[model samples]
Target: MADSASRAVFLLQLTDCHLMPEPGQLFRDIDADSQLRLVVDDVLASGLPVDHLLLTGDLVHHGNAEAYRRLLDILAPLPGKRHWIPGNHDEIGAMRAASAMPCGREEVDLGHWRLLLLDSTSYPDGRGSGSLSETELVWLEQRLAQSTERPVLIALHHNPVATDSDWQDEIMLGNAADFTDLVAAAPQVKAVICGHLHQSQARSIGQARFWCSPSTSVQFKPAQADFLLESGGPDASPGYRWYRLYPDGRVESGMRRLAQVAPDPELG
Candidate 1:
């Protein structure tokens, strides 16, 4: 049986990689592949015994099969049980075909906590906005019901709550109210971790804490009225979130960025 004894489970969240099939291809003027390499290297060097790596989404820029395959190649050496979900920019079919990693699962049991991965991508309309279908909602509720005794950490692609950036808020989860209502009802839920804003943010709503991890490639500027990209300088380095989930239902988390990564000259 999975043990939730005295030890803490180390998990890492890497989001918005935006990598392309080509090695030097740039997304928003940032060399996504290089940045991802740097981020992966940093995580390895950190000496953190990461038990699981939660990839929150936007793994690739164009949703290409080759891109996903390339990403798998790049992250092949990372030591953890890697799981990913789809982002607005990702093609679900391609991602699934390219990797053996499960995309959306009802729950992933980690010793003391249950990690739920949700699909927030809205199809046909093809906008940035997200939605939880009726079926997904039912699935979520069922999972929550079954895992009442375990602390739950939900992972989705888009932020379910407002990030204060008007443009980003518009693109966030369309059914966030419904989503949060379920979360609020489930006392076992400890946190909701996500990506898509490309910037880091943490906020508490009722019992659940919501956290947005910075992108592994380029980051978007926060709290802006309109769409704005982070300046490619010291202020906007690529980063990931580190999570330490304790056996007693407590979570310790923080963001870590590459120390000396310079912003792309063109983006600057």
Candidate 2:
């Protein structure tokens, strides 16, 4: 790697693995175990010196302890410190038990940037929607207040902005207005990252951008009035997001989809 690339903090965001209890189990005809393996293989082959691994959410679909254990084993080879948060599908207790990094440790110091991971599984409405508690909201405000000297990147499992899909939007962050209003006031918050949408999309609030990454398991089709999976197309390939945070508070990010994992035509 070039010195410039090496100097910046490189972070990989993998979301919505949705792994089942067993290796062969499939969600929407996409094998989570094998798809995540492909993602890991892709990262290893790329040879980026990932400074940190930010797993946004949906680490496991079944909320089983064994699946979380399996997730750790699959990702053990990838370099750097790992941090995660709870998704609607995740069992927080199970996830914390399977990993050493406490899910409650929200702030990550990345030299010039602050990475904040928030638990968005509270106050669920049973349709996969989640809301932040009054405590967590206050906590986010406190963190944003203190990070004036460093740029901040906040990660949560729910989308804080609309994906334009009615059904999907219905299940997005329930208090997104509250969330985005918080971001709109914090100029130091460079971006807000999230992943329940299972597709790549960006919306802006104040100086920060809200980015939703593609899922390692399966991707839902974007811009639809109704819910639909992206099946058997270029966009359906398993995907992830990468970011390079520079010391100057400049953040450069892009995404790559693993084309090797072809989408199943019957899934839609």
Candidate 3:
């Protein structure tokens, strides 16, 4: 039998694929199909003990049906469990068609921990806004209530609280306070994982930790002033973030940036 207490759950985080499988490019000089393919290749070749693959969001460039289809094809070869959450650029209809075991909510039991996937997307507006709705909040409260013994990890596409980066702060979740309040009361809530900033960042809110994953496509340079969008400069290597959640309720993570052979002409 599988030793429930001894085993650990490893979640591989990949975000912002921005896949534009067609001939044309998308997202500020990024070739979605090529860059995403490279990241996928790296993930598969890493041979890491990944219990599940989590695509946080922005999997497609335009949230179109065709883009989602292409993404499904690219990710088809990946073994192990997979979970997805929609972002500002995600199409609900397209996601439904692409995922075999599609679900808006995933409550995965990872031995001593529980992973909760939440959808914080307000469609049509590119700026982020998180709404749990009364129904969803109630469900979440109940879920957390079920057991205080298991460490709970919350995953969402938008940053639940302000990150101080002015550019990203504009697109942050509007209902972040409400969400934080909920997590504060729940002792089991360990950390909050998110992707949308297109850059890796970390901040603490209340008793929880909030982390943003770097993109598999183009990256947004860390800002100091107001909102700024980074364009071509030099670094073209693709990157991803790996997070380890310890049984003692501690967390450790790092970024892995790959070296591409040469800059693609399409990007210039």
Which candidate has the highest lDDT of all? 2
Instruction: Return the TM-score for each candidate structure.
Output: 0.92, 0.92, 0.86
Q: Which ranges of candidate 1 are over 4 A from the true structure? A: 1-4, 123-125, 260-268
Residue runs of model 3 more than 4 Å from their true location after superposition: 1-5, 21-24, 123-130, 224-227, 231-236, 260-268
lDDT of 1 by residue, 1-268 (tens): 4555768888889999988767787888878988898888998887878889888888987757888998988887788898999988888888988977787654787877889999988642466877878889999999999958989999999888997899888888989899999999998899888989888787864697778788898878999999888886654888988778888888877878897522212111
- Give the CA lDDT, 0 to 100, for residue 73 in model 1: 81
lDDT string, candidate 2, 7-49, tens digits: 7898889999999877898888878898899899998997877
Candidate 3 lDDT for residue 106: 71
In terms of lDDT, the poorest run of 10 residues in model 2 is 259-268
Alpha-carbon error at 5 in model 1, in Å? 3.3
Pairs of residues clashing in candidate 3: none
Residue clash pairs of candidate 2: none
Q: Model 3 misses residue 72 by how many Å?
A: 2.3
RMSD of each: 5.1, 4.7, 5.9
Q: Candidates sorted by lDDT, descending order?
A: 2, 1, 3
Question: Candidate 2 vs candidate 3: which has greater lDDT?
Answer: 2
The lDDT for every candidate, in the order shown, is 0.83, 0.84, 0.73
